[model samples]
Target: MTIDGISSTQGEDGVQEFDVLIIGAGPAGLAAGIYARRAGLSCLILEKGVPGGQVLTSPMIENYPGFPEVPGMKLMDHMAEHARRYVDIREGEEIVRVKGGERFEVSSGAGKYFSRALILTTGSTHRKLGVKGEDGMTGRGVSYCATCDGFFYKTREAIVVGGGNTALTDALYLHSIGCKVSIVHRRDSLRADKHLQESVAERKIPVLFDTVVEEIVGADEVTAVKLRNMKTGVVETKPVNGVFVAVGEVPSNQLA
Candidate 1:
């Protein structure tokens, strides 16, 4: 069948062919599909999940050029819609294996596809705390993105585990939203920019230095976290309703 006026033919072996195959449907992948179609190349986008990638988890975005403020889901929806008008997008297709050659061969659970060129736009995954009860408490009270989960903790208590920009920013956001926030860093000092550190201090946010979370404690939901002081070797269980682990991110390049 023809998609977006680009001929997508299934060969006798049931392999769909395209000029360019994009392995993700995030901002970069969507943009690449649009550009490829505009250049008169037949393109296909294979996404394992829904479009939008990690941006979908963001609650509010103010840094985007045109709109003063927009929801992450809304912004990604607009981009995906625009891309659909130009290229063929196949969502829910996770690429399982890829073989390189004069023409790349890509395989998914459904079938195989061939493309002269391949674009890998896979994004990143959030790093986890790896502490006890963290996996079981996920979605019950554990979250990786503060902007995504901070709304649930307003007027409640939450702890951000990290000293980087993302962690400090999350703490500031939680505070602004009326959540009693604290910072738990394994290091003595924060690694965030000076401005963000100043903002945290200006807001008088409490930061626990040289501290690490040993375990997340809860029955159904998160009730507290077991913290260990590196210098003094003292262990304490701090009561909290939410645990926002923003240590860092690892690239989602397994398919590549």
Candidate 2:
């Protein structure tokens, strides 16, 4: 797959052009590849991480119709294979920046990939709790998707951090699945919608207001969280099994 005397080299400045360069290899990018190939255009998919993107982080998804329920990783694997049948799928190629024009040029870790059309499907990253062990053991124990890691913490206690809709939603879902959900927020007031607040209050979810997580305590897995009260300036620690960070999500639109 050498192009224009570039010798398929890495860190080269030469541009290798294609009819289409998809910036992600997720479901969206895979779908685009199917259509682009059917349209008889050369397509290339550049993905930074694993080919599945964030979808690989999900557990069992039941909402997607046609199948009763399917494993997220399985679905993504099938998609990647199907898309590869039509388009050239390149994984682990970090696209640093995109220069848009008549022929968009994508600068990657390898080299430049020029395309007549560019599909920006670079998704988002999960928000962090900034706590001690939280960042240290991201993939090991602390998780964003409950469905993915809930089974690992079955019958154990978990803490959800946030005062917004996402936090409340996570609490409700965890509570429904029989995990003791503790809602920890920094502010005394909740920024969630009124209806969502009502749901949280109605569910009798234990909420620690005006308090924030000072640090996540754990060795191999998250075992507890150190808490700090903003108003009283008191610090305390609560033993828990896991920490579900629901602060927010940051979209990966830097390449947009």
Candidate 3:
């Protein structure tokens, strides 16, 4: 039997064992670590990217319990710091394989980790629009989550790129949050359900049908979206402070 990417047979560093091995350093993973440590259990957390996951990229958070508004990274930093007092954190280690049993074995590019119990807090990744500047402008002006960034654009213009339920929901939510909200769908009509469609209309959220995002514009933050009107073959730029891509998410479950 092979683990996700590691062979069943042992290799380089053998296996580094712990009472519990938690994969991912997001909020869930960190919280789990805290609990484990509080219970006097030895726990270790492995993270492949930023310790906060997507929260690290979030510019502002409005509804996180205590604070009315806090920087996403700052909140995560506080979590990481608190969790660190109890558990060990390993960042930049990409876990590729996992073998679960009484003794679970996990392998990352860095090394092998073993534990009596394994917790997967592996999060999901937002699907991108693949337009030019989208990658470079991430967290600047291009965002994939409306809920996380909508509050930052109060009374400001923002665009949603998608046609599904999520896209429609984001558009309506942005409008409700005081944004000049609009949606740009590649298809002639939205793929969202009828109820969502009615809500968009009722909310007066503009829909740009048969449109594709050609580029995400901004230098430090999202400034606008360059859109191609498929029907008219016209390209235009819409000024905005935010661009939310509601294209769904891919889970970090390759090892599951």
Top candidate (lDDT):
1
**Candidate 2 local lDDT, 147-184, one digit each (tens):** 66766666789888898876786777788778888899
lDDT (tens digit, per residue) of candidate 1 on 1-256: 6887888767548788888999999999999999999999888999999989888876666679997889889999999999999987889999999999888999999989998999999989999999999998888899998887889999999999999978887898899999999999999999998988999999999999999999999999999999999999999999999999989999998977
Model 2: how far is 72 from its true place, Å? 1.0
Task: Return the top candidate by TM-score.
Answer: 1
Model 2 residue 16 lDDT? 69
TM-score of each: 0.87, 0.68, 0.60
Candidate 3 C-alpha lDDT tens digits along 1-256: 2322222233336656677789999999999988887776667899998689777765566669997889788999999999887777888999998887768888888888778888999999878777788887777767777777788888998888899977887787788778988898999988998988999998888899999989887778877778998999899988888888988788978888
Which rank order by lDDT, best down to worst? 1, 3, 2
Model 1 lDDT, full chain set: 0.92
What lDDT does each candidate get? Answer: 0.92, 0.80, 0.82
Q: Rank the candidates by TM-score, best first.
A: 1, 2, 3
Question: Model 2: how far is 117 from its true place, Å?
Answer: 1.7
Looking at candidate 2, the ten consecutive residues that score lowest on lDDT are: 3-12
